[model samples]
Target: MTRTPQSARTTTRGIPRILAAGLIVVIAAIAAALGYQSQNASSSSAPSPPSPIAPRSERPGSLGAGGAVPDGVTVFDDGYPAVANLDPDLLRALRAAATDAADDGVKFYVNSGWRSPERQNQLLREAVSKYGSEEEAARWVATADTSPHVSGDAIDIGRSNATAWLSEHGAEYGLCQIYRNEPWHYELRTNAIDHDCPHMYADPTQDPRMRQ
Candidate 1:
């Protein structure tokens, strides 16, 4: 048998060592990849935390802010800020009138009542956009400072029958329409029970209160 050279033996031994080292490196890399994938899977499967509850003092607006009334909301619905936030005397008169209106087969639905200053500003902006000028917008939407709704002293009644009932008997409850142009708009005038309501303004623009 021929003897192998010393160099040949060294080369054959080195090849197996190199291949073993490469295999170990490949195994370590695969294991590391699998560990990372497992970690991500575990993280993805975990349940998320629950949402926080809104504070009790935080009230929702009909327009997603405070002091808006939804359709069909009545004076009796004190749950709404629109009804509950009204001036005490005004709310009292409204409830009294609403009770009598119900007896007459009419419901006292509140179209609009108390309004946040933000909501008033929003309405004013919308009015300006619709009528093409702030001068014209004043006829409909009042400034936040001048709007009785912002002060919870006025309410807009809904439905023709409810307004008709108010037209006929509202003075008994001291509820009076304030604007001739807006029959739905009512304000509490306690003196109206003794005397008829003060002369109606043609619109909000004509009201001296709007000037302030």
Candidate 2:
């Protein structure tokens, strides 16, 4: 029996179809490989977040070597009258500095410390009553937000001779006076000594409550 030419042509067409199928498979495999490689490259290129830092005081204890509070420092809780809120470390530093100052015959006392929001409001109201305006009162007594005393990180220290002494030596104890106009008010300033001294606050003006 003779095979028809048409049958031969159909067999040749089937060869091409098989070849096309193989080509499609090759293309799909290449595409899948490229997609996987792209995904891996993107993942490898992404940046990692930074690790968190531990507090300075938590390091191994070694007399100013680790983060522990300095020697000869005492922690005082003045019943919120001297400080509305005080970090334990800062309180220790203040007591240390004050004791050192006393040794030098420069005695100091904390006149004002922390104030609650309600207490601040009361102060503001009193200032308004005395000054006849909230704005004028703010110049003397800070508004709620601008008042560093509210955080318990600030204190108003007084002593006829110790003010200058404190100004000169407070940095050694991690304390610094804020607002040049308010010589009595000092706040913690060093993270190594006191972690409470963050540079930024919600309001930095003398009285943020008076802004609006």
Q: Return the top candidate by lDDT.
A: 1
Residue-level lDDT tens digits of model 1 in 98-204:
88778889999989999999999999999999999999998888999999999999999999999999998999989999999899999999999999888999899
How far off is residue 117 in model 1, in Å? 0.7
RMSD of 1: 7.7
Where does model 1 exceed 4 Å of error? Answer: 1-64
Candidate 2, 63: how far from true, in Å? Answer: 35
Alpha carbon deviation, residue 186, candidate 1 (Å):
0.3
Candidate 2 lDDT for residue 74:
24
Per-residue alpha-carbon lDDT of candidate 2 for residues 1-212, written as tens digits (9 for 90 to 100): 97779978899879989999999999999999999999999999989878776565454332222111222222353433443246666677788888898788876665556666667777779988999996667666776776666666777676547668767787788887665666667777775254433343322344344364
Residue pair clashes in candidate 1:
61-65
Give TM per candidate. 0.70, 0.52
